[model samples]
Target chain A: MSEPIAGAPNGEPLSSDRPPAPSPEEAIRPDGRWLAQVEAASGVKAGACYGCKKCSNGCPLSFAMDLHPYQVVRYLQLGQMDKLEGSSTVWICASCQTCLTRCPNQVDLPRLMDWLKEELVRRGQAAPEEKVRLFHQLFLKGVAKRGRVFEGELMAGYMLKTGGAFGPEAIKNARLGLTMLKKGRMKLLPERNKDRRWLKALFREPKGGSHA
Target chain B: MPEVSYYPGCSLEATAKDYAESVEGVCEALDIELRELPDWNCCGASAAHSLDHRAALNLGARNLALAAQGPSPLVVPCALCYNRLASARHELLEGDDLVIDEIKALGGGYAGVEVVELNDYLSSPEVTALAKQRATDLDLSGLKAVCYYGCQGQRPPAVTGKADYENPQGLDRLLGALGVTVMDWPFKTDCCGASHSVPRPDLVFTLVAKLYKRALDQGANCIVTGCQMCQANLDMYQEEIAKQMGKQVYLPVLYFTEVMGLALGIDETPKWLKRHLVSPKGLLEKAQLPRQTWERL
Candidate 1:
């Protein structure tokens, strides 16, 4: 069985040779003001964006958004968190980090974009969109139940939650769904074991729930 | 023997059980002790970054912490999971102002836990020496394979470090060790539309078609991958693509471990290879290993 998972800080175990990180209270806004009081702890840099627009280039859903990838970082730099989160720009990033790899400065625009999305979700102030919330819920649901995403089951569950599970559309997609089921692609009962209970305990027992 | 914390991710447990089995079998062969981490979470794999960023890091971090409970580095089998976890590790250690306090927020965080890819582990001289020693009468001379690294496996080479992000030829070397002829293919690390199949099947058909066209044109009998998502995308979505294209494209997808098993003759069986959406039974027949379909893995 897999072990009780830790947070992001636990993933990279740098040796003593690595340098220590900056404090959240030390971070400055793009306006050069001390704005670390309410800042969520993260390693995303507000600068280093070269304005190459590579992230938008690879984003599959970029056309559906109001702002582009580099633009999202620009807004964050200008201390415009409201616009960053209000628009669908951050939600559609795909978090593929394409721009991060291509950036001359190695700017992690996707990471910053993701941080903005989490803040919006935590504040319950996200734009009126079900896809973003549904995406987050599907991920957490998979983690809560079995600690991994069962794609076939997760999709149907997401459809059910988004209220796309019935009527003509459902009937139409039902054939595709049946094909999936017949292929042994879909599981009727999510394989739940005793370890799932231990996972829950580990998650809930973490200090402060580990979220900003 | 060094014991490393292993993350099976989601697919390996059930959907891709053979992968876990083969990995364990290989680990035993190499005397590599793999302690499956307890209370592990998903690596935030494909969807977490799109849904929420911190949650994705948080998700990756959680898994790292489970591995951090000991001195052993993380060994992830699924390339996608390794990429996500490794990316998360890179972010956490970048030492930006935010990571410092995020540590404080989550009390007593993992101070040191380096994430290692399974390919890095498998490609080690130690494991290779063991594989050579454990060699049986496995003749994989006839199998033609295209080593498909997929996007997450090879690219972002800075994060994965398993192979070159730009032009990875490591899998070819691994295949060479197994004595299988690998095709020179251009779309090795190309995108398969990834989890995009869930929301948009149209794009998946296009992506899979491109892959099939390139691999088939390059003379590959099957597509072998380190990612379960990629295997599923190529294997599962091809039928949908054929229906759309109004023709048949029968290029089966096989796991890299299965290919290694074929070469090493370690519990190689038709039933194990059959779970692939495309039955490699005929392909296995082409190789003609010693064990019948049922007597081995």
Candidate 2:
């Protein structure tokens, strides 16, 4: 269930059916109310963070992200949804868990990042990074349909959807495609698992339809 | 001789078919029967989780439920799949009410099945001992390999249960048992930018370039890895990476299974080796191990 109200950067409605955000005064109350919600969702102790930046220091993609691992958590603690949701950090996380595994506080940055991405996708907001988002959409669409990914169909769909179907981009990929074909890596057929309908119903329609 | 329920994941059926074939070949040689998980679906990998957390958990939960029918370790060959499956089990066990509710609703319950990655499953003492015995007549002493653990195998020790995530010893031990030299390199546990290869090949080129350079700097003949994402990215992007650097960077990235299969003296080794982007024929030849048709063709 989703509401038609718009607050996301792309003016898309927030995807979840959760209640409206509390007033600024209620949110910043010193009782740590906002922190509790984050801690509950992420299964991490938000206040336990000493701002040591250990997670940031150890994250492999920190250089590429807008906000480092610790900063995302810090923003979450402060109830800064604007910074948390708008930053490219969430999409760039890669879910590698380097920060989670190496964090002194054992904060689950990867899972938290997943929650953020889920929210972004639900709200139909275009991710700051385009291709990664499109790839995820196409991949899940393939899985939702066939229970598993068909590399040939998936790549072709991706190239077509991205408008690179028959141009320099396709030419560049053709070399790799030929190599894969020769090596038998790219199968021409899609294999359907026995219970395809079950997974198809699960992911539902791809919302935002490849970037609205 | 224990049999395990195997979930080959999507890559193994497609891009990483050699990995699946070699894994089965090696397992057969080790006398470990891999019964395919009946009608298994994709493990949701990074996409499902990114799109919706509950859906991702449910996807993995369904696979675990199928594997639960039999009392065997669930062996997943793809690192991404293994991570997703293991993470789902961990969350279910940790009492994620939503995940547990979804599992129950789907007629799937966690049966305490052990989800193991290929590296962990093959590197167990018994399996390694069996491998050593099987390969007693074969020697790979000349093959200097730097084992790449990549991101999935070592992260969030909670899910991976890897005590030393940074410098995992499983791959090295398995390779060493085959008489191959495991080079000590610094980038063993680094991320190959994971799925970024599909979206941002430019970033992947830089990340892989660093990895290849490290292996090459150590005078390694090739880079061996257990994770599908790591192998695919490094192998698939070698030519592009080499051209970007304007040099002849011909490092053959081999799945550890191929190496193990070779040590076990499997004849299908050449067929598997030929599947690689940057050919490992030269290295296999230089190692003085018995050459397969890969060297000739």
Error of 2 at A145 (Å): 1.2
In order, what are the TM-scores of chain A for the candidates?
A: 0.70, 0.77
DockQ, all models: 0.15, 0.45
Instruction: Report the C-alpha lDDT of model 1 over B1-297, residue by residue, as the tens digit.
Output: 878888888777656665677777767766779898775667766556654454566667766766777557888888778888887777777543323233334442443577776766676676666666676656676678888877776656577654467567766777767777788887776677666666555666776787888787887778877777778888875776877777767787877777777666665435457566676766666656454742332
What digit string (tens of lDDT, one per residue) describes model 2 on residues B181-235?
A: 8899888889888888877777788778888887889989889999888989999
Q: What is the TM-score of each candidate against the true structure?
A: 0.75, 0.89
Residues A144-195, candidate 2: write the lDDT tens digits.
7878888899788888888767878888888889989999988998998876
Model 1 vs. true fold: TM: 0.75
lDDT of all predictions, in order shown? 0.66, 0.81
Highest-scoring model, lDDT: 2
